[model samples]
Target: MGKASTVTSWLCCPCRCLFCGVLSCFLSVLACVLLTAGLVVLVLYLLFRPHIIHATAVSADLTNFTLTPRTWILRYNLSLALQLRNPNKRIAIHYHDVAAEAYYEGQRFAHADLPDFFQDTGESSPLNTAFLGHGSLVGGVAAAGFRREAAEGARFSIDVKLGAHMKLKLWVFRVPGPKPKIDCPLRLKRRNATAGAAGPPPEFRPTECRVWF
Candidate 1:
């Protein structure tokens, strides 16, 4: 009986040692995997920081503008150019459902839709939109304001508001977030009446605009 008890003790001790060794190896491997994953996430966050996109109204041309006093209707034809830029070095931007509007003294007159597009890292894209429509003036107050502006050098200042949904593209992952809004105000110069019968169109400069998400 003494010999049998000694043999059982020796067998159980080896079994316990083997079990402990396997558990230790598994825990070590798991810890290494977790550390590696954490490092990868940290690197990605540093490389792809959030950035604000910028837009500007680069140029505008007023071809034909007329206001009918009897009907209180304003008809205008304008060529507007825009510049969109992405400043992020490591992130691409995808824009969807972009809509733009042209306003004169808070009264909207025309609308345009921008094509959905993807902007690569550090890319600038030019967009051209046309505003050709007739809008009825609200009342005497608006008509009076318009006349005042027209008489003052015939200079017309128009405001454009842009709204779109944007997504960030990093490698194969797409991160979705809130929609982006932009407002660009443009100043159009009166045509050069002395140049010729059909004078040159109005010229505009790049107007800095801000983006909000």
Candidate 2:
């Protein structure tokens, strides 16, 4: 019985050793694969040399803007011209989706979806957006502020923002990249935008947008 036990133990020992060897080889190969993948990523990053994108507010036209305090309604017809710039000379970018919004006093009042397009390396394109709808103000405070601004017909300040999902490409390889967020503060006032005024000569100075990923 002791000799039989000894033979069984020896056979089991070889099986255990074989498993350990296979596991060690697999782990070694996995480590090599991971290391290679990391190095490739690093090299690609260096090669692309991507830079920050810029979106500048080139111009704007505000034809009609009115607010009714009792009804909490805001009506605006505003058009904007924004220039989108890609500073990277080697990395092309594709914008899959983009949305533009207009805000007043920290509240979103209107929005529009822009068309999706691709930007070649170091390209610049002009994008136009229009907000021509009315929205209900949610709070009394916002309504009061709108009324106050309308009373004097002074310059109206609107916060415009753009959000998008984009990808970067080099040669035939494409990598999912960071989404860009662009924020621009617009100040527009017609020369005679008094109470109940309608249209024309609204000045929208060119403004630089703050951008982030």
Candidate 3:
């Protein structure tokens, strides 16, 4: 019985050691794989740190504008010129579902839809959208403000907001990325009817606009 007990102990010890050895090998391989993945991510981030995508409102034209004093009805037609630029040397940007809105003193008066397009690395694309606001009623305060600006020869301000979904294309791999939100505050100089001269189109200074993800 003693000899049988000793033989059983020796057999169990070898089996336990073999099991432990296999588990250790698997754990080591998993750690190595995790480390490799982390390093790859770090490298990618470093390589793409300097490149940025930007959107700007380059110019705008207020073709027609009219206001009825009796009914406080406003009508206007405007066109906006937009530019999208990708400054990355190796990364391209794909933009989708672009939309824009124009607001006058927190009141939305116009909306525009832009086409989906892609911009290559170090390239820019131009976009033009026309906005029409026909027979829109305005509040008394808004009408008063417009009149005051016109009388004083002050610029009228309009806020334009843009939103779009974007993706990054690096060679054959297309990675999902963050969307962009852009705000362009435009100032329009009222046309001078007394001078019998048509004013120039509204100008947008890119440096004054804000762009973010």
Question: What C-alpha lDDT do the candidate models reach, one value each?
Answer: 0.82, 0.86, 0.77
Candidate 3 local lDDT, 1-213, one digit each (tens): 999999999989999999999999999999999999999989987887645567677777666556778887777777778787778888888989999888776778888889999988899888677888775546777887777766765467778888889888888899887878888888766454553336555454653457887
Cα RMSD, model 2: 4.5
The lDDT of model 1 is: 0.82
Q: Put the candidates in lDDT order, highest first.
A: 2, 1, 3
Residue 138, candidate 3: Cα error in Å is 5.4
lDDT of 3 at 33: 99
Off by over 4 Å in 1: 1-45, 192-199
Question: How many residue pairs in model 2 have overlapping backbones?
Answer: 0
Residue 192 in candidate 2, Cα distance off native in Å: 4.0
For all candidates, the clash counts are 0, 0, 0
Please name the candidate that would achieve the greatest lDDT relative to the true structure. 2
Once superposed on the true structure, which residue ranges of model 2 sit more than 4 Å away at CA? 1-38, 190-200
**Residue-level lDDT for 193 in candidate 3:** 50
User: TM-score of every model?
Assistant: 0.73, 0.76, 0.71
